[model samples]
Target: MSVVTEPKLISGNANKPLAQSIARRMSMHRGMSVGLVDARVERFNDQEIFVEVYENVRGEDMFIIQPTSNPANDNLMELLIITDALKRSSADRITAVIPYFGYARQDRRTKARTPISAKLVANLLTEAGVDRILTLDLHAAQIQGFFDIPVDNLYASPVFALDILHHFRGQLDDVMVVSPDVGGVARARELAKRIGAPLSIVDKRREKAGEVAGMTVIGDVSGKKCIIVDDICDTAGTLCKAAEVLMEAGATEVHAYISHGVLSGPAVERITNSVMKSLVITDSIEPTEAVKTARNIRIVPTAPMFAQAILNTWSGTSVSSLFETDTLVPIYEGMYSRD
Candidate 1:
């Protein structure tokens, strides 16, 4: 329970479960109350978004919980409308609590003359009168620099580490941590140090989106159980391809721990046919029907991490430690840097 000084909670149509959990954690003290306004959000004739808040919000600190995950445009519009409604009603401050920020991968222009949509999204949020931003495990860490407001980026590795320790119990040496691509080396190395396991990397020559060439393994993965970790899993192509590479490198078993599972466009079918024994993803964003019913996909509830983060944020505490890496095994010096 956090000692909340003063604040009120308001939620949108997106991600109600996470909102409720945050509300419960932040409201653990006295002299503070929070409630969500019944929002009537609808699309008009030309698919334009319309919204109305059905309650009073005068002088209240408002937090709108929405994950711009699936149907990215609609969810982003919903968040904008929610902020505008609260602002017009004389709310003291408005905070956009997005667990999964979509359009994060477009942080830069890789192709010639392409747009940086992440910066555009940041501009829209600022124009919508959002005073602060709270999100988790962005695909690109640099996305935080795009926001003009105070941005708190939380991490879920601590939550995942505890679950992994529970899964492996006393035997930690048989495990090996792997990053799906070279870009995710930091995340993979951190997890490897946590479990006292060795690290491996995937060398993927990506020809195009949803297409990667399985070249070779970069570390010692032979005869070890492989655990691939990543920040986002969009089409599942990178994940499945990396899994197959680990198998070819003599990994006895393969599993994955991904944060936001944006399983889009035939991802489930491909993951079902992949060699990985299981793929575990967090519920930062709501799971679609395909992901919820997938045979190989398993969801690890992030309720506790969300709860703790909400508590810390409301109480004006440091959340930077939560952003650090995690492990159950003692950290070996050269294996990974503890700094």
Candidate 2:
């Protein structure tokens, strides 16, 4: 029989608070004191990255929590360097827990001569010695095919579903889930199914990135409370525009629940000025001060879900079961009830 090692957790500079939260949840799950691995990830004078592991990881299972969010290149480099360091140190296996996968939007080429950067990132991670991948809702599900290693692509819908239930208690009859664009209908449909709500899609034409030329609502959102669901909200343009169309279609109110809040550029400002009633996002990427102070923006913690995922991965259990709404409702309800 082989020895089973307790998973060792480590993190890069991308989102330390989220890493710490996951560690705390893991400790609770194990019913013992579990601490993060003592490691140093820093930058050199010339902006080069450096990683040094203080503890011995020989034959140990290691998990690195890093989201390649803002300053994507630097964080991605840090994850690669940390994986390389752990590999050289003889860790038995390394799993990268990327809450927000940067460059994922570039999974395919819309035109000739453009590089598929997501595939390139996958190659880099594989070459750097990642044994597996644990990530939340990727921008495109097909991006999972870019990797050779086993990848557990988790969903934020369960968590969002629980939140919607809590906020819309006794109001489900008024709720309707909206997909901001045609491509996101599937994601929106999943949430709609979970909440037992009708689904609507916003058919839009995008001339280019960050610009929505025009849009039309594809369903009867009239007199209904609309909840837009999406994977990433970078500039918030699509979401804000979708909200406008929904309200014009007679939606009583509009809200959004997004997986990765990549609120870059004027995203926060746009959200503030938009007609949407609220914007709910997971803490996949660290929130900026502007995001924190936004009146209608709320962050739902994802640490508990990710912590459970890590525990399941370490024990060689079925991670896909966590995706079921029946399995997640009680888990998340217990977690948020304390708050």
| Candidate 2, superposed: residue stretches over 4 Å from native | 333-339
Candidate number of the best TM-score? 2
Residue 217 Cα positional deviation in candidate 2, in Å, after optimal superposition: 0.8
Model 1 worst lDDT run, 10 consecutive residues: 327-336
How does each model score on TM-score? 0.88, 0.97
Q: For model 2, how does the per-residue alpha-carbon lDDT over 1-339 read when each residue is reduced to its tens digit?
A: 336569999999999999999999888889987788999998899999999999999889999999999899999999999999999998998999999999999999899999999999999999999999999999899999999999999999988988888889888999999988888888999999988999989999978876778998898999999999999998888889889889999999999999999998889999999999999999999999899999999999988889989999999999999898668755565754412
| Candidate 1 global TM-score | 0.88
Number of clashing pairs, model 2?
0
Error of 2 at 51 (Å): 0.7
For model 1, residues 113-174, the per-residue Cα lDDT tens digits are: 99999999999999999998988888888888998789988776766676676676665678
